[model samples]
Target chain A: MSEPPQEQPRPEAEIDTPPRGLPQPEPAAQPPVPAADSGAAPGPGAGAAPVWGAGPPAPPTPQRRRASTVHVLQVIALVVGLVGTGWISSEHFRTVWLGSERDEPVAVDGAGAATHEGLTVSLVEATDLGATPSLPGTDWQPPSGFHAWRVVLDAESTNPDLFACDVALVDGGGRHFVANLFVDSFVDGFEWTFSCGVPEPDDDVPAQQALLVLVPADAEPTAVEITSTGFSSGYIELEID
Target chain B: MRRRWMIVGLAALAVVLGIATNVADARLLPYGPTSSTGAIGEDAGAYPFTVHVSQAQAAHTVLVCCRFETPPPTGTDGVWVVVTLSYATADRPRGASGTGLVLRSADGREFPVSNRTGSGGWLAGPDIWVRGDLAFEVAPDALEGLTLVFDPGIQLYGPMPTQYARIPLDLDPGAVLDVIELSEEQILGAGER
Candidate 1:
């Protein structure tokens, strides 16, 4: 074999000389050996400047700043949403539990007057008209299975205009009875009108009317309820004897 | 920029939720007028019979159109309004008795049927078709927005609920109401015309 080719000396500049105007990297006593599989390009930080040695770290990225801001806003929104939900729940609970109790009806005696919606209602007397009640105009006859009761009342409306009211008799068993219009025509002692308007307040005269209610012979009325046609909540109840 | 977009999306969602809540309340709540006034001749009854308004006339003195065993009562001060109602039904046969009729004015004043007048023929019957007139005495000034109200005599142990049909009157409030003389033919042919 021809004598092996003699090794040539490498240029000095390629080995140790640094580029102009850049700081020289401190050389290690034993240079790091590249791996056998290392590709043509250098790996990260292999030939690049070290983090501590890099020029005043690159300014924070816009994308990163935006992400941090969104995170803070999300935390704030969650707190607000939680607080609002709590407030609404508490308010609803307070109304349902506390408001209804205050509106319960108070009881009053038969002769006593109960006031509601600026109107006063008093029951003067209640009489059980036994079977064979007298007819007002000889035209109609009382139907079978029915009993009649004469109810006298005094009512006055404080409203400027006339007020119409509904008068009903409630039996002890929670059954309702409307006044008999047929008998109502003949009874003369009543001062108040049923479907008709109740007179406005007059200092000299009290508005009084009588109504006749017919019910099944078995009904035993325990109370009388009077209210405006449209206003159901505003009412007065009188306990009957 | 992302934070702003998130806030905008949240606001849009909140507005949508608020609107939905209000819509639900209006439909589900039991408040407000349950029924509105219908045109003349429309079936306005929630019960078995269908009621129709044929004609409404105002007069100072009303002639009792239908013959009764006892003559009807007369009005004293205000003008009388005679309302002719026609009742008919095909499938559901119902009879109405003691219908509490009243006239309500714009000022909240109510004029009940003159107990002294009007025929009770249409009050209770199983007949498929019946026509009758109801009279109310109301002040002339109370004519604007005059509405005829019919109560379906509901017997209750407690206070009466607000349930009734309202029929609007079509007469002019300011015009003079002449004396109306109903011939036997006019009185008998109430719903026909």
Candidate 2:
């Protein structure tokens, strides 16, 4: 009553103070620090304390989370892609190294002997018969535009059983020529001998055979290939001079 | 580190499995029989039938004096070889076609059976004992170390590996083969020795 006791003005610091039991607003830069003296449990209370400051801690700066997720996805894709590429490359190499190797003929020097499956073959000599070559006993002559070649070889069988083989000539242009069959008169007259199949080899000597091949005059023989009749993969090749 | 080891283990397993598959595929492929030769009178089982060579003779000429539904062409001048065989089937009887007789000289010349001579012995079905003669014409000088090769007919679809029954016709180098004549009835009926 003496002029309503003349209410006194509050101090500035007291005017700015928040009410009790309400959360205090923290600075924008620093998150609110939890009260260690308080009896609250650790984990849930610590998480809630950050939410009370600066409007939920600015949603944890979404850039870092998104960037980490993208990084993990990129790593997974890279690993999967690398495994797939490696598998494909390995298969390609396997086929090239093993599967496709048979198409190439086995290479041997002109004087070397090539062996396969208990059989050995060597080219002794190759003779090119010029045009108008004479037959030993017959008056017959080779057809025009065709030339003859006589191939001499030694075939030895190391196995106890008999061995049969085939002979073919590969020209420089990759053409194959078989032994002449139609010129029986000349073959029979010349006394030229060939072993169709070799008997078991003796300790001292192997069977020697001769073949007569007729080819066009322009063909140039590069190699002679010998193969077993039953198997196509195994072969013996001897280069010609 | 454990995950890395797991990945490496899986990769190794994949490679092993691939190699195993390749090996299995190679092993399972169909292969032909190895080339083989047998003597006369030996039972050379060429599948579906068994072949036996009883006798071989060399002759200067072959005369087909037999009656025929279709008489074969006549052969002259060249040396003739007569080969006798008894073909029998064990389980299933099969009719066979084509000639499998070939004459091989010591120098590796091959002369097939002559179609000119008439021999009525054709292949028949199972349990049937068929005997007949096949004649081949060759040069007179080709008689030494003459061998008759019997092979089964070739298969068009699969591998055609030839197994030969080599019957040595031990003809004297200087011996003269006489001219022989056979009647059509004698040739058609089980051949006369």
TM-score of chain B of each: 0.62, 0.64
Query: Where does the lowest 10-residue lDDT sum fall in candidate 2 chain B?
Result: B184-193
Q: Is model 2 an incorrect, acceptable, medium or high docking prediction?
A: incorrect
Docking class of 1: incorrect
For A130-225, candidate 1 gives per-residue lDDT tens digits of 656764544433445455688888776665443567677877655556554324455545433563344534633335667877555666888887
Clashing pairs in 1: A190-A210, A191-A208, A191-A209, A191-A210, A192-A208, A192-A209, B73-B116
Candidate 2 similarity to native, TM-score? 0.33
Off by over 4 Å in 1: A1-111, A135-141, A182-186, A190-192, A195-207, A230-232, B1-193
lDDT, candidate 2, B1-193, per-residue tens: 9769989998999999998866654454332232335556665555445566676777777766565553443556778877776675433234334366688899999888777775634643233345667778888888888887766664522333433356677766666567555433111112212
Give me candidate 1's TM-score against the actual structure.
0.34
Residue A144's lDDT within candidate 1 is 55
DockQ of each: 0.04, 0.01
Native A-B interface contacts kept, per candidate:
0.00, 0.00
